[model samples]
Target: MEVKLHDIGEGMTEAEINCFLVKPGEAVKADDPLVEVQTDKMTAEIPAPRAGIIKEFTVQPGDTVSVGSTLLILEVGEQAGVPVKIEKNLPKPAVAELQAERLQSFAAVKRKRVLASPFTRKIARENGITIENVAGTGPAGRILDEDIYKFMAAAQQKPKLPAQPAPKEPAKRNDKVTSTIPLRGRRKQIAKKMVHSLNTIPHCTHFEEIDVTELITFRNELKDQNQTISATAFFLKALSICLKEFPVFNAELDEEKEAIHLLKDHHIGIAVDTEEGLIVPVIQNIEKKSIRDIHKEMKQLTDKALENMLTVKEITGGTFTISNVGPLGGSFGATPIIQHPQTALVSFHKTKKMPVVTEDDQIVIRSMMNISMSFDHRVADGATAVRFTNRFAELIQNPKMLVLEMV
Candidate 1:
C-alpha cells in the first residue's frame, strides 16, 4: 500500500517531512504514527492505514512533498511474507544474550506509547532525554515541554566528577565562525505573507495617544470586586463596537470583482509572539461575547499559540487583527502590517504616567498609551480610519460606557 501525503489543513498544497517515527521493516499496528510532517502553520503526524510492516520510505527527512505525493510503502498481511531465520542449536551464553536483547527491544517499544504532541516530542529529542523517564503532569499523563525541562534540571543537580585538565591547543588562523538558520517552516510562511501584504495593499497608518487613566481606575475597581479582566479584552470589545459603526475597516477588497465585502461576524485575530514565530489565533464572534468571555478565550488561545498547538480553525477566518506589544515595552509606536486580505490592524503600545491638563485647566498625572492603526488605503481613507480609532479611544477612556454597549 502506498502511504501518501494528504492535505492536512485548509488549502495546504505542500509540507516538509520532519522525521520518521517508525523504521523500515518495523511492525506497526493499525493507526500507528508513521512520520511527522511540518506544515506552514503546524506540525502533524501521519498514521498507518492498517496493521502492516514498513517496507521503505519514499521521502527522507527535510524533503518537501505535495498533496497526494507518496510518503512511504507498507506491506500488509500476506504481502509481508519475508521469512525469519531461526537457529536450531546455539551456545547457551549466546542464546541468553539474544533473549535479553529481545526483552530490551520490547521495553523500548512500550516506552514509545507515551502520549505527547509532535512539538513536545521535538523538544525531548533535541535535549537527548528519554521521554518515558520524565513524569508527565498534564492531563491524561501526557508529557509536556515543561516536564522535559524539569527532568533536565533535576539531572543537573546531581554531583559530577571533576574533569582532568589537558594541554590547550592553538587556535587556527584560517578558521571563521558564523551561524545560519534555515527559513523553511513557519518563518518562511511569515516572510511570504509579509511580502505579499506589502506588495498588494496600500497601507496607511494613523497614530494617536489615548488617556487610559479612567480605564485603569475602573479596572482596579473591578479587581477589588473580584472581577478581574484584561485590558485587551476591553480593547477587543471596544474595537468590535467601532467596527460596527465603521464597517469599511472590517472588510476585504476583491480586486477581480471590484467589490468591497464587509464582514459582519467580527472574528478578531490576536498577534502572539512565540518561539517559532508570530502567530495570530482568531477569537470568533467578538460582537456576541462579553469582556470576561473574551479574556478567558484570549488566554486559552495565547497559551495554545505559545505551545504550538493551535488548530487551523483556531487561526483562520479573521476579519481584523490586533497586536498588544505593551508588555514587550515598545512604548513609542510601530507601523503594524495588516494581515493579508484583512482591511485593518491595530497595535497598542506601553502605557506610562505623564502630566496632563484637565478640562478645567488643572494639571494632573494621567496614564496614557499610544496606538497605531493601519488600514488598506484602497478600501478606506484616512478620515474614516481616524473616526474609527476615535470611537475606540472614547470607549476605552471611559470603560463604564462599554457596559451600555454590551448585550
Candidate 2:
C-alpha cells in the first residue's frame, strides 16, 4: 500500500521531509515513526498507519510533499500486493517548470557524495566551504547547516594577533566568509506562526508591575520546607483561578463559524525554548492542579521540550499560554503573541528587588516582577484584559491566597 502524507493538522497542506526514520525493507509496527516532516507549525514525526515492511520512499529528506501525495510504499500484514497506481490530477502548466527543476535538483542530490541534505549542501557551496570538513551534529552524525554556522561563528571568534602580517598568497590568507542561512526547520515554522498570529490577531497588550514581596517570602518558606515550587507555578495557579471569572481569556475564536469557544478546561500552554525552536506544551486541566502539581508537570514538560521529545498530544490543545522568560535572564516585560486559536498569552519577566510604596504611603524595597498579557481584541477588549491582569496581580501580591492551597 502507498503511504501518502495524511492530514497533519493546523491547516498545513505541504511539509518538507526532514528525515526518514525507517528505510526500505526495515520492519516496523503501526504508529512507529516513519519520517519526520517539517510543517509550518512544528516538526512532527509521521507515524506509520499500519505495521509493515518499508517498500520504498517516494519522497526524500529536503523534498516538499503535499497532502495526499505518496510518501512511501509499505507491505503490510501477511499478504503483500503491488500498490495500485491511481491517476493524479495534472498540475497547471505554469508550475511544470518549477516542478521539473525540483525533480532535477532531487535527482542530482541522489548523485552527491556528501551525507548532508541538498539544502545543507547548497548552504555549504554558497559559503565556499567543503561539506566533508564540516562536522555533523544531527542524528547518525549527519551534517546539518547549523553545524556549518556554528563552525563559521567559532572561526570568526578566534583572536588574531595585531602584529601578524598578511600571507603572500591570496588563497593562503584566512578571511571570513559571510554566509546567509535560509530559514528552514523549526525557525521557519516559528516565523510563519508569528507572522500569521500578528497579522490575523488584533492584539491588545496590558502591562502590570506586580509587587510579589509576600509571594516571594512565602515561596522561600516553602523552599525551607523542601516543597520547592517555582514562581511560574504560583502564577499558573493564579491565572487558572482568574480564568474561572474571565472565560473569554481562556476561550478560542472560530472566525469561520463566527462563534467563540468558551472552554471549561483550562489547558494552559507553557512556552518553552529549546535547541530546535520555541514550543508550547499544554498541561491539561490547570484549574484542578495545585502549585505542586503545576511545578512537577511543568518541569516534566520543560525537560521533554528541551530534549526534543515532546509528543503531538503535549504540543496541542492549549486554551491559553504563558511565556516565562524569567529564568532565561533579566527582562522588563515582553508582549507575547497569542497562541492562536487561544485568545490570550501572558509573559512574565525576571523578578527584581525594587523600591515600592505600601498602602501606608511608605516607600520600601520589594520583590517586583513585570507581567504582560496580549489578548485578541476581537474576543476581549482592553478593559476585560486589564481586569484579568489586575485580578491575577491581586492573587500573586497576596501570599495568603496561594498559601491556602500549597501542598
TM-score leader: 1
**What TM-score, to 2 decimals, does candidate 1 have?**
0.84
RMSD of 1: 6.8
Query: Which candidate leads the pack in lDDT?
Result: 1
How do the predictions measure up, each by TM-score? 0.84, 0.72
lDDT, residue 102, candidate 2 = 40
RMSD of each: 6.8, 11.4
Q: Write model 2 residue lDDT over 167-272, tens digit each, in one string.
A: 4434434766344455767677788789989999999899988988888889899889988988888899999889999999989889899999899999999988
Model 1 steric clash total: 0
Backbone clashes in candidate 2 total: 0
TM-score for candidate 2: 0.72
